[model samples]
Target chain A: MENQVTRVVFYVSDGTAITAEAIGHAVLSQYPVSLTQHILPFVETVERAREIRTRIDEIYARSGRRPLVFYSIVAAEVREQIVASQGFCQDILAALVSPLQEELGVPPQSTLRRTHGLTKHNFERYDARIAAIDYTLAHDDGMSLRQLDQAEAILLGVSRCGKTPTSLYLAMQFGIRAVNYPFIADDMDVLALPPGLRPHHDKLFGLTIDPERLAVIREERRSGSLYASLRQCRLEITEVEALYRRHGIPHLNTTNHSVEEISTKVIEMLGLERRMF
Target chain B: MENQVTRVVFYVSDGTAITAEAIGHAVLSQYPVSLTQHILPFVETVERAREIRTRIDEIYARSGRRPLVFYSIVAAEVREQIVASQGFCQDILAALVSPLQEELGVPPQSTLRRTHGLTKHNFERYDARIAAIDYTLAHDDGMSLRQLDQAEAILLGVSRCGKTPTSLYLAMQFGIRAVNYPFIADDMDVLALPPGLRPHHDKLFGLTIDPERLAVIREERRSGSLYASLRQCRLEITEVEALYRRHGIPHLNTTNHSVEEISTKVIEMLGLERRMF
Candidate 1:
């Protein structure tokens, strides 16, 4: 209940809420502290500053705690004006730097001190959602596993057969964006390749490791479950491979190959056009 | 015993062992899995190939496991020559691309899979270590905490104090090399800052958040220990701030600053040059 207050506020250039949000997300990642962030942009007015302060007050009152309020867009002139205006106190709402230095015990030159400021002031221009989507596409996490439209190719595999990690490796090591789907027992029923996969089947590839290895990995996750049984895993793999064969899906057995090895083999096996460097 | 024996053998170009060790010390990261890479320069002789292969063999034999062996300097012809002369097969050995694909379910692009291959192929001319270090500097764990000499600055703080992530935002946005160092209690006791740090106090910046907020984070991590003790943390912070004030350490209390706010303050406070557009 005490943790429900906002502690940080991110300021950005005019009309850059999304940029501030992205940076806020990035900032939240470093420390494990609990606090919410309020986005205040285009802080050219005392009215906006007072509004932000009021909002902070409401958050504290509702949560029965005064949350840490951060100000990202607090400019020099704005600070001067706010001091004269009602409800804004300059003493409590200092910049974030002094505290961080005191916390880390870093001397003046420790690059750690300048890390965030440099990134925010000097970062790539945040293109709108379209570009963000593109970046995410180029760096897909392989969760949906559904057919990838933008993907030049797709990979189908059994769990722990190394699908998500491999897809990421492909995207990063090379610029070729790849999408992967795990072959769960649920997917075993998905005998027919989804419609989105048909156009890219020639570019599509499948990977399977030994059933014993698959069982070993599954066991690590669930110790004793129908999901981890060797017999079911073997059958699932066998069925998936047959489905791939029936549908003319190019397949590889990744028994001993590392993720890098398989990626190379897929390129060699499928003769797919180079999507990455 | 078994896990210790068969450590992965990764062969790359030079001087990256420090980076490799830093990265490989972890089991698997969000990016590339860091293994004990045996970086080898390109060798032209059959005897050298044999020597390298024998060393690789001993690494595997001692580990009692077939660690993912990644050979980075391999050229197309070099791969062919190594295979032809040393009779290395896929069952035991793997080049960067092929093995990685197998490991990750990624399709390997045969071009520039090796370390030197990456160096040669990268339009950016530098050694493999430098290339990897640069790439990692920007995108390690998809987080940007600039570590190399390239970083222009850093942000330091306690857990949830927003250091690593903020640095990344700056780097990605500004193209500035930013790193973050978490300040531990030991850092305070040392009386002096770490080497390479004393001279850069002019560039040093800090971020501090509210103690109650920090307490919430500590509670999440330790729940019931001295970590969650508000009194103890308050004392630590008071002492740290005293030290900062004693040394004229200019820092910002992130207690009320959003990441953007904190970053902007850093820029203003340190008069740092911006790297991003």
Candidate 2:
């Protein structure tokens, strides 16, 4: 058997640690290694930083291998503690920031920064994002049709075809007010666009899935039922896809795409404004 | 008046441009510049790449300044097109990946990478994330108490105290099954832990907000109503906070925190497993 190398990886941040984790994951995905991951977020205090440092040192002492640390810290004191650790520490944001700074010919604003933190300037945009989430939940799975006009994008698909997650993602990630309506087993016979959605035809997007994949997903939800049977899955997909073609709606197959991919594609296809919060 | 530098920024990627946007946003936040942003995802084909190159060149010609492009493309031909554009381009992932590669002593797997794409290997984890989203929605706003035992975390807070969005974020981002219950005005008079939740006290987390901020948020939902009044907001906050203290529930103030911050804090405080999907 081939020897597989293992490493302990830590994603540490003074704030949410989301960016640290994101960049670290992307970077590490390129290498072939097994990772035991630890995420340490909100390490703002010097005391917490020392504790993390000690933890890293102990892991190094026990394993005889320096753990990898990917971190972003705004505070000098807190950052210093992590830098002192017995680990292969990488400042996730500093590399990119320095190049951009040189390019822009300006010194970085020397202050505590919060990449994922909410501030007075961004509070309004943040509120809009929350409101979008509210609007999305209310309109999920055809729950409410009263305010279809307010929706930026309306998703049409059969049940378990990946509409709810995609709608919520659009709202959560981009602050887009998204509405998703599912075509159920009952609606399979006559899968037509609802009258309310007709007025918002331009906002309509569709999602379809392969029958084999659909059956597997449905089987997990309802085992040994007709809903999970391949034949029914095939029929639903066929009818729903035909409906999409008849309506001239831009659609995507959800069988292979992740929620992020689906949401980004939907936004791009519909030309929806991608508001960054 | 001092001349303020304004730049056009583009985030391009062969996959979902989420990572590019995230790193770019974090890096740009350090600089004092006004940015006009464009995000182009799935720039796989040479045709799309060429089209984007032209668009970048056109913007440069019109503005008499080079645009800043932050991109991550896997294909050599496609990446070459973007690199050849008349923009100051930066490979967002390459900077960090190279240093890490030297440290790990391994070359990167030279394959088309998708940071946000779903694959057969990660399909199960991806499914669990979707399931977490499903679980969170079903349990949102105290919708279902049947599965309290299955919940990873239970959030208790007053209305609009940043519960639903946080719960969804916990699920969507970390695949943690989160349930949020609101303490409404009706419950204030007889405020006590619901008998159903008492069994799962270890899983309980409280969210409180400043009365003044609470009033503002409530006002947006229903202006000039008693529910949105300062007095009501104060009373509800006081009662819920006391309940948190009395029950020994670990809690946080959501007044100044974003959903990302709140969710990260909650996970850290509870020592919940942070699963990266």
Candidate 1: DockQ? Answer: 0.02
What is the C-alpha lDDT profile of model 2 across A133-241, one tens digit per residue?
A: 9999999999999888799999999889899999999999899999999888998777788888998989999999999999989999999999999999999999989
C-alpha lDDT of candidate 1 relative to the true structure: 0.48
- Clash count list over all predictions: 87, 0
Q: Candidate 1: which docking quality band?
A: incorrect
Candidate 2, superposed: residue stretches over 4 Å from native:
none
Q: Deviation in angstroms for B41 in model 1?
A: 17
Compute DockQ for each candidate against the true complex. Answer: 0.02, 0.80
lDDT for every model?
A: 0.48, 0.91
B5-63 per-residue lDDT for model 1 (tens digits): 22354432221121222222211221122235443433445566666666666755775
User: What would the per-residue lDDT of candidate 2 be over residues B1-277, giving only the tens digit for each residue?
Assistant: 1566999999999988998999999889888888999999999999999999999999999988899999999888999999999999999888778877777888998787678879778879999999999999999999999888789999999999999999999999999999999888999998999999999988999999999988988899999999999999999999999999988999999878988899998998998998876
Report the C-alpha lDDT of model 1 over A2-71, residue by residue, as the tens digit: 5432344333332223333433332232233344445444455666666665665665566555433223
Off by over 4 Å in 1: A1-147, A272-277, B1-277
